[model samples]
Target: MRIKLTYESLDGDIILPKHYNYHIQALIYKTFTPDLATKLHNVGFPLGKRRFKLFTFSRILEKGIPTKDNEKLIFKRKITIYFSSPIEDIVGNLAERSFKEREFKLCNKKIYISQLEIVTTPKIENKVIIKALSPITIYSTLYKKDGEKIVHYYKPIDKEFSKLIEKNAKKKYHLLYGKDAEQMSLEIKPLKFSVQENLKIIKFKDTIIEGYTGIYELLGDPELIYLTYETGLGNKNSAGFGMWEIWRGKESDEDA
Candidate 1:
């Protein structure tokens, strides 16, 4: 349910906003059937609740590091996308419409689909460790001094972190599946992490949230784990947050 994509600048140069992750996600949805695309795009549909969405993605990468050449910034050759929904429509939709040499708009700039590769990650086990392929953003209500309410555009590890992740992960599971998700014995503990700060789209506006790219220990139902894998671990997943990959090992091991 994941794909590695390589796009080349159709015009030999392309420019994107520094916070361009959401744009790439949109292009992917537009490649699907019109109705599905509309469904995916209408984030507020279904009674103003996103109850029928699935999938996540990794960061759009550039070769080594991005280099600025005057007004244009050069990017890497490849980026990746992941889909967790087992719905045939999404898979079939993309397969039918993914035409080679197709053009896409990222941050209103043009790029051609150069290469596409499907990748498979390990299935959820009774207990497994997961690492973030992209940063994760959660929506939580926290109170500050004088009872000020804080919207978690980005939340640090707090008493509510574990509870929020579990709550949201289960809620997404129910959204994808009609029945209530079978909450297994689970502990969402952040073992290792590095702060990932960035801009995210909320109500079509730029917002700063404290997101993190890191690893967590999961002990729960296999289905729950798989659902998290497909849809992402936190909110705004459909908008490019909370995608995960299996931890290979220490960076020095160069595990492949």
Candidate 2:
């Protein structure tokens, strides 16, 4: 089976640290038939006594811009896995079962299995691809009310912020040639939020970048507010993806 995973930055404009490296490792530990275990172990998959081959995999870093108050600044990375057997049969009998039997944590963040899709290739290839979507929500601590006990907070989505987000989600540019004109391109959305006040509060929501998700804290600073957006996937390595890539009002006019 051949699997291709693509990660694209949905929003934000910040550059990720070059030293950051995200790692993705599969854990296959469970009671399996001796034959099956041996097959998996031989391929280098580290499945108890079984092994599996590691095919093509890559990590990509991209950029995005936020258009809303709660929009997320993000960076994206996609991983693809190619196996020798049918993805359904392999993932169903082995992958799914293994994940359930063991505890897998990425970047210390608990992962929630999102979706599994089986894709069929053309006759020339005659292959099947199983795509699994998993997401990890990185949470910070935030107080529900002022002076209240600090608790873990996850960003939530709000529909009201859509209009505001749409109006402001644009790539900003400052022209250096001729008359120093300002330029903007592409409307962006928010994917996640981080709590500025409570570092333990983590929030998730599905909304376009132009929408409003609600306010957590107003620390009297315009740039220090917290908001919510869709969460990204994280791996064992320090490298990961984020949604808040660009600032809401800091779009530049430079040509890429």
Tens digit of per-residue lDDT, candidate 2, span 152-241: 323323332232222222100111112221232221223333333212222212211111121121111111111111111111101121
Prediction 1 TM-score vs. true:
0.78
Superposition error at 85 for model 1 (Å): 3.4
- Model 2: CA > 4 A from native: 2-22, 27-89, 98-103, 125-256
lDDT of 1 by residue, 1-256 (tens): 6666666765645555556665666777777777888776665223234454666666664533345643234565444455444455665567556664277777666777777666676777977877776676777668998999888554436656666777777676666566675544445767675444332333313665456666677777787777777777877776677787777667612211
lDDT of 1: 0.63
Highest-scoring model, TM-score: 1
**Which regions in candidate 1 have their CA more than 4 angstroms from the true location?**
43-52, 63-73, 77-84, 142-149, 153-156, 195-204, 252-256
User: Whole-model Cα lDDT per candidate?
Assistant: 0.63, 0.26
